[model samples]
Target: MNPFLPMTRQDMENRGWDELDFIFVSGDAYVDHPSFGPAIICRLLEKHGYKVGIIAQPDWRGEEDFRRLGRPRLAFLVSSGNMDSLLNKFTAAKKTRHEDAYSPGGKSGCRPERAVIVYTNKLREIWPGVPVIIGGIEASLRRFAHYDYWTNRVRRSVLMDSQADLLVYGMGEKQILEIASDLHQGVAVENIQDVAGTCYRVPDFDYVYDYVKLPDFETVAVDKKAFADAFADIYLEQDAIRGKKLVQRNGEACVVQNPPAMPLTEEEMDEIYDLPYQRTYHPMYEKAGGVPAIKEVKFSLVSQRGCFGGCNFCAIVSHQGRIIQRRSHASILREAKLLTELPDFKGYIHDVGGPTANFRRPSCDEQLQRGTCRGKECLSPTPCKNIVADHSDYLSLLRELRKLPKVKKVFIRSGIRFDYLMLVKDSFLEELCKYHISGQLKIAPEHISDRVTRLMGKSNKEVYRKFVQRFKAMNERLGKKQYLVPYFMSSHPGARLEDAIELAEFIRDLGYRPEQVQDFIPTPGTLSTAMYYSGIHPLTGEAVYTAKNPQEKRMQRALMQYWIPGNRPLVREALRLAHRTDLIGFDKKCLVHPEKTAGQEKNKPRKRR
Candidate 1:
């Protein structure tokens, strides 16, 4: 059996290793699956001839759990699991979430808030000079000075706050190996500043060269325009091919972020996924019922990585970069066949996609050579003219997967870029509706208002409407009764009360009741989050309306699910606030009925008493 990485001293001794080259510390329970970031990083290190161990969800209050594996010879790789800790532990309302999918038995509070910073601080206190390199979603997104939604303030770069020697951003395999090789050659961590896709702090300007200087942390913390400007500079230079080095000062220290690592080739992506992952949570957590997050990805195959559908609210572009990196179909098929051998697969492949399911290649051929266009999106406002928007490769891949023996059904559960879908003049949709979708195909239009959609970097309402009509027509032609489950967000920056009301009206007209609506959470390092914090669009330098007040946010959210009886009062209040009381009436178009007075109730005709 392929065993998990050593997690305890005995496991290390069982492997007959005297010393480990690296000890990975993560805020999530040890799930030795490719879907888990820590697992991938550790497995990749192991593949590269390094003896690595893991310390998963160690107690932050003391050093006892931190010392389980002892110090590594090279460095301690740290991460806040797959998600940012605050996002995992708190709802969009900032209320404490009771369940953490990444934790054992789905328990919350397994890790502290600001886990990257907390874990790094603890490690620093215990092992003074050992290198602590922070990455994963928490460190990657927070590598720069950013708006902290929990604190409602601008915070310094995670490198400075966590006091980590180096911070790896984006997908970390390339950077981690480079850092490891340098350290193995006896290069000091402090001197390892030139690695791409990493951020390192320097005492002064002496270490900075050929870099774009963002507005200092102090200036951005106080000045909204400065904050917007700084974020714009940061956002524009995220491309690995043409991106420049970035520097920002936090008090006396300067944080320098090198250009992103080059996109992984097909062979590289294949190699990473082909690592001998045990493909399950560690046995130690079986008593606690294992990690809940594994259930979603255990039988699923990740067909691709990185998304080009640059939704402002999504951080995929920031974390995974825009250039599409996908595994060859043979590799994905190999994984699919592996899933068939699993005891619990049930002949069903849960999903076969990534951030944007349909994106199997770069948005356009030019992006590969010149990087993503500066200040221009491939499929937003409208699909770029140069975008290939081909689905042949993806469709072929899906067809091959469906033919694999013992695979009864293959599904595409990940988000499909509908706008990109619309661009493809092929049988992709027909195959999708007939084979992949299970009665209902979910799509994210986000909002119906063109104004909001523009700000969201999503295709307009008309695009979604056209796609809906096509989907319905296709389902009808196939004599199938399929429905569209559209997702909409509430209270996003640039979305006013009226916009929310308008969305409710659209839902009312469509005769669709949304069971679940997403409320915008302004997490760090996205354009939407920057707009939410600064009240200005970072890229456009224009004022954007954000519903920051809890009451107003509630009202906006209530408008989306106006059909819910419990949300009626807030819906009514939102209608009144938006001066859209016209929607509160007896008409079919009205979202809610007017409140009946006591006198009116008394005057109501009784049935023949």
Candidate 2:
């Protein structure tokens, strides 16, 4: 049977079903591709012999928009699409975004703010007593009481705010299936508490034994130190094997979090990938630019999942866990072959990696047996002795894909852990520079200052410097004129005015002006966000400096792009504030030249620090 889940009541009527077992509410236009979370969850439900329907990007102002599909027989599944909804609607500076790739026509404001909470609340208003289960990146990251960067304050768990019956965290396949099975057996939604990778609200914590109790919400809400302390404990206990159940009190009600779900094995991964995906947005969106996000991944393959890079600024470890799980080579090749048969395959495969491109296996052998260590990292300060730095499997997989009939090139656009790449002594770099690169290869070094880099849990600039030397050497040897586009961030926690100045100087020396620069966004689940909210390092509990002022943040961003004529005023003011006016003179070493006469500087640029 060709199982494409219905999106409307008439579609369900055509299939001889009176009512759907599940109605999935999404904040994005429905794309049936496997890369989309809502599509995968809905299809997985359908494969289990349940009727499922979708309500994608419905207007959330009142009950009229949510009434498209009446109500499901079992429950309603809610998600904020692939990316977090807040990140989709706003930039790091809290400015409203003008484009949403997940929406039709690349329009913005199609979804509500704090989408999961807003959608769930509106669902309850329309369909009273319908069980609501929330998942996806937004709910998963905010399952517990944590900071909310948008409001600049600590907020309770999304479970409490949204009033959803249950919350599924992490990769939700196993948990969602278990919930469905129990529901099919007539179990109440309120009683589904013991499932792994889930969270539920309770009247009290009396029945929850042997679970770690975080400081109550009230304490953490008012005390910065307490918030950091609670966050550190949560970070350490994310391991599936070593973690215990967690409990947190929010007034009279308590939130209980089950341990993370174990990673899927190769066979399980193969089954999930082989699920029938339409691999593009529904035909209904063809006139509206076809969901701009699909253009990046339409021909790409997902070779792996989960990251062991353990960067503090990233939430992958929290959401996907630290264990590295991947699909088999045969499985990926099958997907690539199917792509060649697609009408849109244009001889190029855009990407072939996940969270991190080069990670093919666990960082070390023991990770599968015993979970990742609490306070240690795989490749930040230094690579662990037990770390296995091999790319033979991934390299072989790429070689097989390249030999496919219609495939012309395979690129690795996802992040590449340069620190790990530098540790391996092989021809991988040469091959990457020669074949996989799309004109210019992109890598993230974040920042160069040792102080800021340490706080971000990234390797120091020395390691990045060495990698740059090797990358240049490899390109030279291969007789290719390729460029290294390094990603840099400004105004991260622990970065001072002086540090921003240091970064501006580094950009000056590199002679490369970045077209895009990211200001650190303190999304809910990451360690760096905790520090940004509490002004204390979660692991260290030490007070860290944060550039929170609006003008200061603009200055830091402007300094990174000092070459822009429009940004000269902000850059000059930033330099003066840092007491680095010596850099404003007309010298080769200076960032900006001194002021000159209108005629004398007509061709010359103006400097007004």
Candidate 3:
């Protein structure tokens, strides 16, 4: 019999199990790859002798779909898939997307608009008193009071909205096991309070000892500064070792977030990856063109977890925390060998990375024990003196993978910390240019303005410039015709028209036209989103100028692709708005041609005689 957990009642009966210990309800199609959260959790539970069933993308409008798996003996786990449902459904401009990559056949609206809440509410209607737990990227990051981009308001924690018994945040291997063990021991869900990396609601603040109290929901909802202040307090206390428990009042109940879970050791990471994941979508999805989300990760291997890059716009710091946990080389190479045996074994291993590709170890030794410093970052503004920037272990791993029999190529698609790369004193860049890059190497400089970069928790612009120069020199040394594809962002929290113009000038100097540009979307749990909602820097509490105007944001996006003929008008308008008409004439310094008078157009000189 196949080892995959039962997806239907028939599959369960065939295995001679009358009931399951858990039924995981997900918003994404069932892809039994390790990259999918439901697969990992189910596989892990099964490994511990627990019978698990999966209910993927259940119909949200009614309870019949959710009841397909019957009721679990333990609890029901709910997740909004790998991405937040609203983010998956809409573009940055709040327009509905035509396709959902996580859905079968790339279909739109396969899941509810607010998946976690909808799924949990429906499960409650079907099995009223059963314990329902929410996790994954949605519940993990939004476990606290946060701003919802779609609603355009400060909303209470997802814990309050979903009414789940508990939220298992972060990467859930450690927390979920603990929760399962406790529940199996007959403890009530409400009493499972002391577990790390979990959140539970209470009637008052009495039980939360020595906890930090955040600005109440009412205050943050009406006052922008209070929102910023609340976010600041939450940001500083994310570390596992030094962090304190946090409490936020929501209506009559209080939401309490326990400290972050400690990072896994090398052996622990190996065990998680060694589970028997089919590493592909469930066979049932084969008819509907399969799940599109698996193609990107089918050939990819997640070498590590957690990131210390601390980019303000990213939610990793909140979800994964600012620590790095890596899998051993033996484990990764073992997975590579398994890939070679698969029928679809393309010679290329698409990626061997995580949040940041080259971060194979923690940033520094002290961070492993003392935790990340409060109010200080490892690579933004400047690399800290204690930061140990080394890539020898990562480079060694790549070389080992190259030596495998059937592996033709290996690429690094996940982001690399350019600032950390610049800090390393090795031939990592040369080797990366020679072997790893797939023609064009993509890196994110994000923006050229130091003001905006600072707000982004990115290193100063000079650092990216140095990395670009080094990349060119390395590619030239290797005699390769490779190009550097730099990514830039528009209209983030601290960006203004002048900053966008400066970025446009920077792109002009590069002589490269970007086909795609990112307009900042204030997703929940990011410091940038807090700034977007509050108009105040969470770290500094100073008011910032955010480009909220739709036309202005379009203009900023146009400036990045100024070479496109259709974007000329928007670029011209942007230049004019910034009072930089000098850049509107048809000259070497201009971004777009200025409007010409009829008389001047008629009298223009002609080359023909």
Question: In order, what is each prediction's RMSD in angstroms?
Answer: 1.2, 2.7, 1.7
Which residue runs of candidate 1 sit more than 4 Å off their true CA positions?
A: 603-609
State each model's CA lDDT, in order.
0.92, 0.89, 0.90
Could you give me the TM-score of model 2 versus the true structure?
0.96
Residue pairs that clash (backbone atoms under 3 angstroms), model 3: none
Q: Hey, what RMSD does candidate 2 come out at?
A: 2.7
Give candidate 2 regions above 4 Å deviation: 1-3, 596-609
Candidate 1 vs candidate 2: which has greater lDDT? 1
Q: What is the per-residue lDDT of model 3 for residues 1-609, given as tens digits with 9 covering 90 to 100?
A: 766678888899889989999999999999888898889898889999899999999888777778788989999999999999999999999999999989989999999888999999888888989999999999988888889989898889889999999999998889989999999999999899989999999999986799999988888889889889989989999999899999999887999999999999999989889999988887888889998988899999999998999789999998888899999999999999999899989799999999999999899999888998999998888888998999999999999999999999999989988899988789899889889987898888888799999999998778888888888888888899898888888999889889988988887887878767999999998999988888899888788889898999999889888878899889889888889999998789799887678999899999987
Model 3, which residues run further than 4 Å from truth? 596-609
lDDT of 2 at 262: 88
TM-score of each: 0.98, 0.96, 0.98
TM-score comparison, 1 vs 3, better candidate:
1
Candidate numbers sorted by lDDT from highest down: 1, 3, 2
CA error at residue 440 for candidate 1, angstroms: 0.8
Instruction: Judge candidate 1 against the unseen true structure and give its global Cα lDDT, from 0 to 1.
Output: 0.92
Which candidate's lDDT is highest?
1
Q: Between the candidate structures 2 and 3, which one is better when assessed by TM-score?
A: 3
